[model samples]
Target: MVLASGSPRRKELLNNIGLMFRVQTSEIDEHIDAHASPQDNVMKLALQKATAVANSCDDAIVIGADTVVVLEGQILGKPSDTKEAVEMLQSLQGRVHEVFTGIALVEVRAGNIYRTQERARCTRVWMKPLDRDRMEWYVGTGDPMDKAGAYGIQGIGSILVDQIEGCFFNVMGLSVSLIDEMFKNWGIQVGTKIRSQGV
Candidate 1:
């Protein structure tokens, strides 16, 4: 198995679940299509990443994932700088936002593409009200710059969240339950696989 991303959060999630997978980061242009819906955009990017990596594998299941924060129909990606991070947090405070994560699975056999599957999950998150001081303080920690919506729910940014309405793991980057469901379609039981490995 292969994970087509370099995100430490995703790697850790898989590791914690006892899944043994190699990392093969894909270098694709992650350009969000303005015309596409948030779900479509994420799923498309995920499929692109998985397909790119699966092309080089002889026999492997490549998993790709993409996540984004959407507020009022606008997508908020990673902040480019600390200033932008502060701005993003300022805007998100005291408001409800939706996090969309797309997952794609690409199956390769004999050095050729055989099958592909993709799905998306959404989680509603509410951010706690924040003042400028708090926003700046959080930005100073340098954790928000690399996260969507300028926050990481599983990290220190957990304090910034007031509540959540869906899969908690989706906010972190990948949803293990969703991945397991997808895996079932291929007749691969993740739980059984883990048990077989004595994990």
Candidate 2:
């Protein structure tokens, strides 16, 4: 099996589930469409990553995923710089935002491709009201610079979040339950030690 992402968070998630897989990051345009719904955009990006990585192998099951933070119909990806990260965090404070994570599984056999599954999971997160000093101090940690909406719910940023509805793993960038559901659709029960092409 293969994972088409370079995120350590994603790697950790898979490791926690005891899945043996290789990392194969995909190179694709990740631009978000202003008019596309968060669900549609994430799904498209995930499929693109999966298909791109799958094309390089003769037989392998590849998993690709994309995550985004949506607020008031605007999509927020990973902040490009500290300034942008701070701005994102400032806007997200004291409000409810949606985090959407899309997952795609591609099965390749003898060079033939079988599009197994593509779906998106959403989680609603509520952030505690933060003053400028608090937001700036958090951003100084440099954690938000690499996260969507400029916050890492699994780390120090967790303090900024007041509550959440839906899958907590989704906020972490991958939803293990959703991935298990996809595997079930392919007749593979998770935790049964199912191996793929290699490791």
Candidate 3:
């Protein structure tokens, strides 16, 4: 199996689940479609990454995933710099935002896709009211620079989050439950590796 993302969080999540796979970052652009819903955007990006990697493999299952934070219909991705990171954090300080993660699996054989499966998982996160000093100090730590929505729930950003309603892993950029279901759909199960015939 192969994971087509360079995110350390995603790598850690997969490792925690004991899934043996390799890391292969995809070279596709991460542009979001302004007219599409958040879920649709993620799903499309995930498949784009997965298919890009699958096209180079002869017989392997490649997994591609993309995550984003949505606030009142606006998509917030990784902050480009300190100022943008601070601004994003401030905007999300005391509101509810939706985090969407899309996962795609592609089974390739002889450079052709045999089967494909994809799913999107959403988690609603509510952040506590944050003071300017707190947001600035957190931003100085440089933790939010590479994270979506300018926060990382599994890290120092956890203190800013009041609560979450959905898969915690989804906010971290992957969904174990959703992936398990997708694997089952491909005749693969957690803790066991069994590829169905013709898959």
Candidate 4:
């Protein structure tokens, strides 16, 4: 299997599940069309990422996922710098944002005869109000610099969050429960490697 994302967090999540997959970053452009709905954009982005690599890897099952944070229909992307990171956190303070992760799995073979999946997982993330000192300290840690919504629930950024209303793993990156269902729906019996992990 191949993972077509550059995120270390996604790699860590897969590793934690004991899945054997190779890292191959996809070069698909991720520009969101202004007219596209959030669900369409996320799913298209993820499918593009996976199929882009499927062009090169003819013998592997490819997995690609894209995460986006949306509040009141406004999409918040990765931070440009610490100041932007702080700004994003401050904007999200005391508010609820919806996190969407679109996952795509493609089977590769002759002519890449395969299937494509685009499933969106959402989590309601409520952040505690950000204080000046606390926000500054969090920005200093540099964890928010590359994350969507300017926070990571699995790391130091967790301190900023009050709670999540849905899949906790979706906030981390990939939704394990959703992924397992997807795999099964695709008729892939995940073998012994994932049995211990409750897959």
Number of the top lDDT candidate: 1
Local distance difference test, candidate 3: 0.91
Question: What TM-score quantifies how close candidate 1 is to the native fold?
Answer: 0.95
* Candidate 1 global Cα RMSD: 2.0
lDDT of 4 at 21: 82
Worst 10 residues of 4 by lDDT: 190-199
Candidate 3 wrong stretches, greater than 4 Å: 194-199
Give the clashing residue pairs of candidate 1, or none: none
User: TM-score: which is higher, 2 or 4?
Assistant: 2
Residue 2's lDDT within candidate 2 is 90
**Candidate 3 per-residue lDDT over residues 122-145, each given as its tens digit:** 999999999999999999999999
Candidate 2: Cα lDDT at 39: 94
Deviation of model 2 at 21, angstroms: 0.2
RMSD of each: 2.0, 1.4, 2.1, 3.0
Residue 25 lDDT (model 1): 98
- Which model, 3 or 4, shows the larger lDDT? 3
Candidate 1: where is the Cα deviation over 4 Å? 191-199
Q: Which stretches of candidate 2 lie over 4 Å from their true place?
A: 196-199
Ranking by lDDT: 1, 3, 2, 4
